[model samples]
Target: MKNLKLIVFALLLTFCTTSINAQTADEIITKYIKNIGGAEKLKALKGIKMNMVTNYGGMELPVEMVQLAGGKQYVKLNMQGKEITQMASDGKTLWSTNFMTMSPEKSDAENTENALQSNADFPDAMLDYKAKGYTAEFVGKETKEGTECLKVKFTKKPIKVDGVQTDDVSYYYFETENFLPIATEIEIKAGPMKGKKSNSTMSDYQEVEGIFFPFAINMGGQDLKIKKITLNPVINEKDFAFPAIAAVTAEPAKK
Candidate 1:
């Protein structure tokens, strides 16, 4: 009789432990979506437009961004009265033109071959990371910005960028209480910046169209402060159009 009771107790404990671990990942994901407004609300956002101010190299400049469904994105920056722009759709084609550069350069064909290869970071990507050729795993819990969070690691499949092939790995710290992504650390596997690591922290989330967005972003690497960003009010569809320069270029050249 005592043996039977002990056996049942052991089985119950095992079941509870399995249940807790199973609950953690999905629960965390669901809570995060709710904090940002439910998944339904986020799906309702057809487009996003925002004005941004980025501080880098001891200078602050205004920039703009437009994001749309079907993996389309556009970014514009005004530097010394010159407008620099970059656009991409489904990651297959990209255009980046800057008055500062002697000539406009396109990303290597392999780099822009798929939506996931594009440089733009969209919030929706987090929804179904696996299906997008990304691998994610729980890396336990840690503290960030004075808040406890779950650390998740994501690795991207090999892809070419600028004619050079590379892979990327990133660590995200999601706050436990709110499920908001608080910090990110990324490592690049190839290129001039190969083996380099970058860290970014996100904060100042604001609600827009029932979704939460980080209005401020700061990225740092190798003593390089890429930018401190602050986003503005609206985004327009026309802003995401592909540039004429990109249309003229057939394929990116080999490095």
Candidate 2:
């Protein structure tokens, strides 16, 4: 009788363990998308305008960013009542304003391409990933800082420059309990930080338009705190155009 009881307990434990590890990559991604919002809602998402307070070296700086569905984005940082830095893209061309000159110049070709490739997608990268020529693989579960997380890796389609390889990859860590990404890892392939890994932790998830979004992200010592987020805000082409006024003024575009 005692031996029978032990065998039954072992079988039950194995079943539970298998159940916990049974989630496939697609299933995990689907659950993650559903937990935040459904695929249909995410597909209909057109644009977003967000106000962020960035912490840098003990100083808090306010930054306003606008992003459209097809990859156009603009970011403005105000400091000392001045338009200190600005970056904008028109889906194809990328330009930026120098801090001192405030003159618009074409950004680096590699950086521009990277931004264009990454920005033209869902706020959550997992949405329609397969359709976007990307593939994801299940890497099983791991514990992060006392939290059990589902680890997954997604491979970006290979990038090339004059027949040279420049493809990059990204990793995501989603808390098993909520199916929300709490952290991400990436390695820089270009620019000054080439081949260096960067890890960011996300928390403070708040709901916006039936979707959950991380309102806070800590990367190294810098923190991005979202103050406001307006979906489908009306954005004029000029907002992302070069040669703008000395000052930029914007209000949420009427839905």
Candidate 3:
């Protein structure tokens, strides 16, 4: 009787180990994709454009985003009547301009650093996380916004940005039952806002061209708040054009 019990216990332990190992990187990634929509639907996307309105401390600002299939991206912001732009063509080369400060800058060490950090908010990048050489793992489960979710972390492989090489970690909380990402948190790498933690909450998902997009996003950190967001607005490539200038700089305006 004692020998039989030992055999049974060993069998159960082996079964549990096998089950855990069966959860591969591909399987984990596929689950995330299916939870959103599906691989087929996501692959069908060619481009996306969206408009966002954010209110922070009683101030309203407008932002526009555009993304292409091959990891190219663009962002334009109109804050208090000042326009700023950033764009990336191959994930390495970046260009930006700040009409708000009347400064035009080419992609350099600092500009590239800022773009790499900002790319986290792009929806297209989220969908292609695996293909971009990013590693994702199931970090267990938690509750967010009254919904139970699986916590996942995306760690980017070290790469050169703005002439500097760095790695970043981003945490995402995905609704366990639905697999939709609800919240994201990232640490700033290099900037005046460096060393500060930033967060964004997603809501109001709507389907555009067979893919779902978060029409509302609330981002806040460093006493700055992005209070509202809009999606699927008309934008042209010319809007991301950078003006001829020496370097980019951010300075506090006089009061």
Which one wins on lDDT? Answer: 2
> Arrange candidates by TM-score, highest first: which order?
2, 1, 3
Q: Report the lDDT of model 2 for residue 37.
A: 83
Local distance difference test scores for all models: 0.66, 0.81, 0.64
Query: Which segments of model 3 are wrong by more than 4 Å?
Result: 1-28, 56-59, 79-93, 110-123, 126-131, 160-164, 221-236, 244-255
Task: Score candidate 2 by TM-score against the native.
Answer: 0.81
Write the residue-wise lDDT of candidate 3 on 167-236 in tens digits.
Answer: 7688888776666788888887766888888887887776655556676666773222333333334445
lDDT of 1 by residue, 1-255 (tens): 999999999999988876665466556666777888886776666566667777657677777666665567777777778777754453445656644663555655554564434443454656655567776666789988898989877676666655655666688889877889989998755568866877888888877655677877777732212233232325444445454553565688889
What TM-score goes with each of the models? 0.71, 0.81, 0.67
Stretch of 10 with least lDDT, candidate 3: 221-230
Residue 202 Cα positional deviation in candidate 1, in Å, after optimal superposition: 0.6
